[model samples]
Target chain A: MRRNKKERQKQLKETIMENPFITDEELAEKFSVSVQTIRLDRLELSIPELRERIKNVAQQNFADQLRSLPIEEVIGEIIDIELDQQAISILDIKREHVFSRTHIARGHHLFAQANSLAVAVINDELALTAKANIRFIRQVKLGERVVAKAKVINKEDAKGRTIVKVKSYVHKELVFIGEFSMFRSNFTETGDKQ
Target chain B: MRRNKKERQKQLKETIMENPFITDEELAEKFSVSVQTIRLDRLELSIPELRERIKNVAQQNFADQLRSLPIEEVIGEIIDIELDQQAISILDIKREHVFSRTHIARGHHLFAQANSLAVAVINDELALTAKANIRFIRQVKLGERVVAKAKVINKEDAKGRTIVKVKSYVHKELVFIGEFSMFRSNFTETGDKQ
Candidate 1:
């Protein structure tokens, strides 16, 4: 019975990894174990109860993508947070930071820096971007320091939706502006996920 | 004259990164260097000449934002590419590969897997996403092997635009479907960049 339980736990871990959203009842029925046992197994595996798993999945994906790229020209760090609503961070797009390219860092870099700061500030683990609309109002020449500010415009937990507004500037001149809508979910539920 | 020249080159590199879309002659004038020196600098930096830089700078922004997260799980690998139309990759989402508050891998993982494949298939370095619409059709449960596929639907070089369709499947059953619009720019006459 002990060996059989260990094997069952291993299988359960595999199942949860493949699809972190499977419920306790589902696991119990599939593995012929009580729901309580399955919960215990989850705890043993160090998997975040349920909410942590969902959020970790999203954060992990972002980290994985970043690892695949080659970047050498970033001068910013996230400094603040506001849970699920919004975040703010500051960046110093230095003049001599040779960006592996010949031109100025495009507007997207600024937008991306601000967006990542916002993502980090969101307290949840599972947040996916639904929409991002941005406008480039001014040019951000080299050596000009910039500040990025992001704020959540709307959040509906029941509906699993959130929106954010991000703006970047250099010495009071708007350089980049954007609005993003993120899809949030807890492993216990999955629906209308677009 | 030697020190002045070196200082001018450093300034030019910064200016170029800030305005990757500028003409070589314009950049030369801005930094008091010959266009030839700018060309040489671009080559040293492994970047394209001029026109390409402009196009590249416009599109490669938000992608940088998503890549700021840290790596904890990698469930997919891109396999092949077929021009400006379609990209194909394979993914193995396992139970142990999960992260965050949610147990299930976030939707962005699947999206990033598909998006990265599309970017890889592009001939240029900078591929900017204009729009991406996705639908979760079925539950991608744990231990279920899956595959992701992306196909470009449209390409418009003059406006720097490309549209692609993405789909994920398990055992031949569709699990997710998506549409992505990405913009491409060469960044200069030198090379394709992301």
Candidate 2:
């Protein structure tokens, strides 16, 4: 594994490309080089740091991630996401989100935030909510911020639907929860479900 | 199985109270009486006809039914319902229901109609959505009316939750669908779910 600089740098670029999450220390250990040497080689290869790489994986269309709709289509600000795995987002409840008389956040606003997050977490060209089961644990008041988390239950089921579970919280208290069955364009059906 | 007039009238009222959807002919056959006699007995008992009885079962709290909430709490005008069974309602898409830019009906409005209908169909003093799965098949337009139907899937599960399914339609085309798990006040939890 002790190759010259040119060969090591070439392999280093390929390694980082294959696994963007590999840290500098791990890369150094893999190549039997110092962490500083690995860092220098990464700079020459124009590879970003691990944190940036993870962010890029979620934000950019690189590595076939984020192939769904544009981020603007998502209702809230997505702070963290890993395609086909999990994602988190935040939404500020405003006047537009509440009932005029009750001042309670509408259930569907919470649903849309969760639905769009589920769609965003799928690494496919098209992600649509075929079915969803959701509940409001408590009334969300106006001016409160709702934080939503989405986790993919199954990458693809036998019926060619991706299952995602979402939970929405206001101030760490559970306010809403939902399970979404997503239909992705990439999966082919076994010819039973419609 | 013939009875006196007073006894027949008493049993007729009890039968209608137990099952509001029962028809006059069915009641006559059950009592071994003529349809005319059944009608006379119902009249004497001040019990309304089958149609009115079904409506009263949904609207009034005469028989431990319609206890979840008042009819005013339901989002749309309820056309038909049988507690812990099935229900139907219609929501006219007005100016307030649509998004200004797209002129498309907001998804939450449809969900609210469905959610409230689901809550209405539960035969309990309190019904809260513990979870729901929903999907929007097509976007509703500004002027289109949405018809939502709710059906109780399970009267009570082992976890003491009632499963309700709802589907919304626009001009006979499916627009939205949802399956909700409702927590009811009357059904005591067997002590597992939260």
Candidate 3:
């Protein structure tokens, strides 16, 4: 059941694309190869290590033109966005994000991730939160990967407001949810008034 | 009217305590002295530069046992906190917090600052946000100082919920306001359930 070198390399590339944070040991186990073999395949494919891949993905997605806010302010890595339609972001809770005493991820970090994604999904020159209703369903821990998905549910053209719905999950279990009422200047006939 | 060196140095320390990010040039203008004199006074008082002072505040406030969340996740410098009573925090928006195309600060950063302060005010080991209602009153820009104050408005011991009201201002103008409903495990007498 061993694939050829060329086939293995192609599959390796695909796997990394699907999950940039996958470690070499995990890849080796999945591919039924030694760690050295996995490293060699990665080298042949010109794939960098896990950290580099993550950094590259963040830099590439965030360096360009964001309609509403900067990538650094998004609170997570925006893997995909379809301007005012749908968006997805991934937040990896680190040591700094958890309580030193309890080791649970702070609630605001989760909220920040979800709220920022909601704002980033809007297609506008200026987007501000008029109001937000949010709920935290579960306590997230350190080193967990939280994926937040945002969708524009309603757009009020006359009022110049857009409603965004955001839900965050850790391992497919809901951790947080938010509904954001956003005011976008671009949607208003008045030119750039706060 | 230029004051004596002793009087000027004493006032300099108070000014820095009131606003930690005040530049030496501004201090000089206020004190009717040169920037060099301000630097000398700072050296005499053993006060570090503005950058170092900000760093020290962050490190000092975050390194201790925070009642609710970690210091690094708070999104601002917690200058003062009295458990379950009130708290004050400072957030300085920088280049990383604003859009590359626009200089306005992202809305979530402000939200994060306010929400975290709300959680940190609770005097409990485990405090979770059950719900929140928030409004962004105005847009914040880069290099602005956001000061957030959180006050405990309600505590229902039977319901095991506490309500905190947070108001954030940039130069005394309200920028954001939020009301957070927090659930604390200690209030329930259940002995730490998730």
Candidate 4:
């Protein structure tokens, strides 16, 4: 069905908002239009590109939704967040993040970015990472923008540990996975330092 | 507490074997000798510097003790290992491991060196990391040599999951710590892929 340009443009805006990382080719395929038409529609709607949209979302979200840690402490920019619930952040790997011999992004940078988002999701005044089980599913290369999403999976610990699940991806491909155990400082009962 | 050079050099060899990361200055303090005297003693005894000693140990250990993963697959070189009991590896962070602007070592390399040691300590043909709980105690810097030790804490699981404890240090200061749950391929009954 061929919808009017106005209707198509409105739907396009919704689609982009739903998945900010969606590529123009994928959007064109979904909207049943040429790539050029999608671009033209996006231009007419004054919606910035995916990169700009991500930046806008991050800058806007970090101002109010973040409470557990300062914004600068986060390894990546928080693109979206709901404290004590879920948060999303993005990190762009550069020359310094990868091995000089091989362009694979260092694993700790990815973990730092994801772990920072995981730590940032707590609503408490201070959250300390108690534990994490993680895996590197794939190698991330330099220049790739990794998006990490951290969600609170469990907060029912009697000892006050909130389990935050963090998954980082290069676009849609899963690159790293981790579950972080964050402890609220006020409820710290962990004395066995092993 | 001061000893003659012959006696001190004999003890120094043993001390270096026990802790290969010990520096010349520390050896001097221990032997009540000047730093240059310690260097002269090391040369007389054909003892390599700390960096060379570490590389030698890793190469020697990898040739005989490594079983779970290939030598290349392990991120850092294994300096010492006792199969399913415990293992140690070393990673020297360089310019590639830090933020160009900050010079602080990235976190994942620390995890990788530890995680790899955790995996290498397992005696199985295929051991997969099921979970890891880790913490970064301090920011690592470029030019730091990270020594990660992994020891199997428990292997008594009915379902065959082994818990490995990994601790990474820079000159005896804790830089990173993790507890890794490794799943051997033969023992995997994990239908719940969460």
Give the residue spans of candidate 4 off by over 4 A: A1-79, A82-85, A89-113, A119-148, A151-194, B1-65, B95-106, B137-142, B188-194
List ranges where model 2 is wrong by over 4 Å: A1-67, A70-73, A82-85, A94-106, A135-143, A173-175, A189-194, B1-77, B81-85, B91-110, B122-126, B133-146, B152-162, B169-177, B185-194
Model 2 agreement with the true structure over B62-138: per-residue lDDT tens digits: 22455676677678778878889998899999987765544666566787899889888988776767777677787
**Candidate 2 or 1, higher DockQ:** 2
Give the TM-score comparing model 2 with the true structure, all chains together: 0.50
- What TM-scores do the predictions have? 0.43, 0.50, 0.67, 0.50
Using alpha carbons, what is the TM-score of model 1?
A: 0.43
Q: Which candidate is the best by DockQ?
A: 3
Residue-level lDDT tens digits of model 2 in A60-144: 6422445676676677878888999998999999997765555767666888798879888998876666677677778788999
Clashes of 1: 53
Structure candidate 2, residue pairs in collision? A132-B133, A132-B134, A133-B132, A133-B133, A134-B131, A134-B132, A134-B133
iRMSD in angstroms, per model: 9.1, 5.2, 3.4, 6.2
Candidates sorted by DockQ, best first: 3, 2, 4, 1
**Candidates' lDDT values, in order?**
0.59, 0.80, 0.83, 0.78
How much is A148 displaced in model 2, in angstroms?
0.9
Which candidate, 2 or 3, has the higher TM-score? 3
Candidate 1 lDDT by residue in tens digits, B1-194: 33376676677778777877778888767766678887887777676877666545432432332231111111265444455656566777775433333344434455556555555455565555544555556555556666888787776544455766778888898877766656566433222222
Error of 1 at A119 (Å): 5.0
